[model samples]
Target: MLGQERSRSFTATAILFLLPAVAFYVVYMLLPIPMSFYYSLFKWDGISPTKVYSGLSNWDEMLHDTIFWGALRNNIVLVVLSILIQLPIGLILGVLLTSRIRFVKLFKTVYFIPMLLSSVAIGLLWKYIYDPTFGLLNSFLRLIGLQHLTTGWLGDPATALFSVIGTICWQYIPFYMILFMAAIVGIPDELYEAAKIDGASDLGCFRHVTLPLLRGTISMASILSLVGSLKYFDLIYVMTEGGPNHSTELMATYMYKKAFHSFEMGYGSAVAVAMFAISLIAAVAVMGVTQYDARAL
Candidate 1:
């Protein structure tokens, strides 16, 4: 009886400690989801006195919206490019930084500068770099007699999305590099020593030992890249506002434009709900695949 009473007391204390965080999560995270869905079923301007019930019309409209499809395609491209470009480059930098190279500290500081800047600042800086008239990129092209190659980088539909994507990758690569660096640091030196003693070359040791050990970190990074790409906004919005014929449109940017800019709150809510669903599905799929691969190994 005494032990049962003590256990109850401990459980009560634990609940007391967790109450604030649980309350915050429910209020900020869980509540917003259902509210978004509710708003999605109405045609309200977000400031009006009355909300007209639109039922499933918003969802139906989304299904037929070509722009939404384009934005989703862009999001997918971002996800693929982010994983393909960021992970390998970050891994290389991580390996380089962790190795006994000269001026390692300086190199690290230089590489991490992009991650330190705000998205808006980086966007503005790169916008000038891509400017058609007297921009750094065009000036360099002319200096090298490659004037034909110089054009409005962010203004061209063919290049706008790719240009923005490149900037995004540059800004984020350092973050993944740091993540990889930490994971590499946690690896036991004994494993590499044993591989070396077994006549393994640096490349061979990395392929056999390092790659296998860093699988979990790689999987986690891939998931992070995936989700982040899906919900990406700010920088792209600042750079292009999904312009040049909406070539750089992303789901988040489109949603913001619909809700706040265009004042189509209901449609924006629908887009938001779609984004949430897609992100949740993608994250679940990635986690499931990673778990399956782990179990298979």
Candidate 2:
């Protein structure tokens, strides 16, 4: 009888601990997600006094909308580029900093500053850097007698999308850097010492010891980067706004355009749904990959 009373007390305490957080989530994030679903069935400007229900009509239009596809393709590009470029570079930098390299703190801080800055600030900063007219990049290229390498990075259609991608990658690299650095630092020094006693070269030690142990951390980083890229909007929207012929339109940007710019609230909701679906798919894929790799190890 006493034990049963104690169990009840424990359960009540746990409920008390969880209630505030659950309430906050439901009030803020969770409720809004379902609200989007309900709003998706109605055709009305957000300010309209009358909402006309058009079940599945908006989704049907979205299925054939070319712009949605472009945005989705751009998102896919960001996702691929993020994983391919950011992950390896951040991992390598993390490994170097965590090693017996000189002035590790200084280097880590320098790399992390970009991440600490606002995304808007980073976007504006990169815009000037990529400017063709009297910009630092062009000036440096001319100084080095590589003047032909200069191009209007954010303006040229051929390069605009890539330029935005680069900015996103640059701003985000430090986050992955810090994540990898933490994982690498948590590894015991004895592992490296044992590898050295076995006469393992630096590369061999990294491959054998560092990579395997860092698997969990890498998986986590990959998931974050993938999800962030899937829903990416701020940098691209600020820098290009899908300009130079919509070369950089991402799914989130497209949703914004439909919702506010075009005043098609229902269709915008549909786009939002699609964006949600795409993000969910990408997240699931990364999870699957991480699980498979973890099991193989």
Candidate 3:
């Protein structure tokens, strides 16, 4: 009886200690979520008290909204591109740098410089680099006598989407590269030694040993990349603001445009909710698969 009373007393004390954090999460995260849902049911310009609760009208519009569809498609493209290009490329760089190379630490710092900067700065810097009129890319193309390749990257509809993807890749690849390097360092040297003793080639040893051991880390990095891409806004906003016929519009940017620019607060809230739902689902799916794989092992 005494032990039970003490345990209950300790539990109450722990709850008291956790109260501030719990309150913070509720106020900052949880409350806004439901409030956003409520806002999604109304029709308001965000400044007036004349909100009309139109039931599912806002959600209905979002369902058939072409811009919303475009935003969703762009987000999907970003996720696919980040995983397909950024992660593999970063892993390759990590593998090479972890080898018997010179100035690996220097190279790492240089590579990660862009990622360390503000997204706005990175986007603006890349925009200038990709500028057609006086940009380095155009200058290089002209110098190589490939003047025909010079075109306004963000201005043209054809290349705008891809240009944004490239910018994101440049800023993100170094992050994954560092992650992969850490994971590679954590691997046991005995595995590689045993593989070499068994007459395994370098490529074969990497395929059998390095990759298998780095599985957990790669999965974690991939999941993070995917989630980040899904909620992406700042860089795209800084560079293009979904310009050139809204080619680079992502869900997050789209939601912001709808709420503030278009003054469709309710509809924008619906978009935000949809975004939250999509990210939540993707995170859960990735985490669930990773957990299952671990349990199987």
Q: Estimate each model's TM-score.
A: 0.92, 0.90, 0.93
Scored by CA lDDT, what does every candidate get? 0.95, 0.88, 0.91
lDDT of 1: 0.95
**Model 1 residue 100 lDDT?**
82
Residue runs of model 3 more than 4 Å from their true location after superposition? 1-16, 295-297
lDDT of 3 by residue, 1-297 (tens): 569889999999999999999999999999999999999999999999799989999999999988889989989999998999998999998898899889988888798887789999989998899888889889999999999989999889889989999999999999999899989988889999999999999999889999988888888888999899999999999999998788888899989999999899999999999999999999999899999987776
Q: Ranking by lDDT, best first?
A: 1, 3, 2
Compose the digit string of candidate 2's lDDT tens values, residues 168-272. 889988888889998999999899999999999999999999998998998898799888888888888788877878888888888898889989888888888
C-alpha RMSD values across all candidates: 2.2, 2.4, 2.2
**Model 1, range 1-297, lDDT digits (tens) per residue?**
569889999999999999999999999999999999999999999998999999999999999999999999999999999999999999999998988889999999999999999999999999999999968889999999999999899999999999999999999999999999999999999999999999999999889998899898999999999999999999999999998898999999999999999899999999999999999999999999999988877
lDDT comparing candidate 3 with the true structure: 0.91
Candidate 2 Cα misplacement greater than 4 A, ranges:
1-20
Candidate 2 yields a Cα-based lDDT of 0.88
